[model samples]
Target: MPQSHPFARVSILCKTYDPESGFNESHAEVIELHDDQPEAVDAVLKYIYTFEYDNIVRTGKDKTRPQFHLRVYRVAHKYQIPKLQHKACTGLDRACRKITLQTSGSKNGSSSEELFELIKLITEHKQYDHSFNTTSIYLVQRYLSPLMRLKTFNE
Candidate 1:
């Protein structure tokens, strides 16, 4: 029987095994990770072994950086990995800053349609509520403040 792999030893996945018994002698266990995103899992695994992950900040029309970070954060939280959670949160904050800058600096700013999509994406994820992080709340406030001012004056 083969020994447990090094990567599995440090992860929460290993907690299921009894320390007194060798993992190789135990019955085969199948763990299904249906709720986790493959990309997010890959990123967390890479970070676990290498202490590094791909930057979430990139210029593109996709705007999936925040989504990726959110997914990673969820995975980390589920797996009880504090270090990964911290990294994911930091990445999320950074991505939010980049997104804010991109939208605010645009010649016409983000269109109402784009803003609506952004709001929908954030609100759809429970992890993005006001208590999750200040950056997310700040982003929403920043975008809404201008609209609120315009509406107040127009009324």
Candidate 2:
């Protein structure tokens, strides 16, 4: 199929896929050629969601996986978005507290109940405000480990 978007310059010097080594064999074939923005986005999303860094590490200690690019991650740190960072911190704190409570609860006590209590504490504390959309809230909660460490607003 022909790509619908204009071709954009890609910075990759060279790439190779070795399925026996566990890299996505499919992406290996086409990644060397320059691609359009949409194609690049699609490819990156697929790789980030599915590619396992551990698997690549085992393949070769020197070569890192194509999953989350180190360069991109560095850029994120350089131009760090404050609001998102705050949300991330709050989410992490809540997650750590929840995990601790869950682990320390008595063997006879219910894990579900403990989780519910933690949820209650978070809600009562108003860590998330009324303005938070469902998707953003979900993302913050789901990635609580990383997000909770951020300096988020009290509400």
Candidate 3:
């Protein structure tokens, strides 16, 4: 880790672990992400090292899946990487906007219930977080009208 890297400022990595003390010897050098998805972790690492991460979440037709970016945002927030968090948030917002625009918020888009799932996902991860709450608001207030109008809008 270089001196200028934002990851260098993360508290877990900044700990002065003593080589001789061997504290938590089994995993002293590892930063476990038990709750994070592998792709999100990969994206965070890629951003940490290279500062670019658009390709990891793209599906067919250049349409980025919002769930992937949401995971990236969660991991970035957990690791205190504000830049990556913001970037992922922007990606998610754009993805939602793109989907809604492409389907004109009707017919084809109503089947894509991931907008509601995204809100549920954020709530599961962090109920008290401003970022998560704001994202939920954006999903519900801004982009959920069409889906909400549908009769199958359960959960």
Candidate 1: the clashing residue pairs are: none
Per-residue error for 51 in candidate 1, Å, reads 1.0
> For residues 72-128, what per-residue lDDT tens digits would candidate 2 score against the true structure?
222222323233223333433433333422246466322434344334433443333
Error of 3 at 140 (Å): 2.9
Model 3 misplaced stretches (Cα beyond 4 Å): 1-4, 10-18, 25-32, 55-63, 101-112, 123-135, 141-146, 149-155
Ranking by TM-score: 3, 1, 2
Each prediction's TM-score versus the true structure: 0.59, 0.20, 0.64
TM-score of 2: 0.20
* Best model per lDDT: 3
**How far is 118's C-alpha from truth in model 3 (Å)?**
1.9
Tens-digit lDDT track of model 1 for 23-129: 64245575557899887777777777766654432323332466777788787777666666667777666666665433556763455445545545555555533
lDDT-best of 1 and 2: 1
Q: What's model 2's lDDT at 91?
A: 37
For model 1 the local lDDT of residue 15 reads 55
- lDDT value for model 2: 0.34
Full-model lDDT, candidate 3:
0.67
User: Model 2 — which ten-residue stretch has the worst lDDT?
Assistant: 5-14
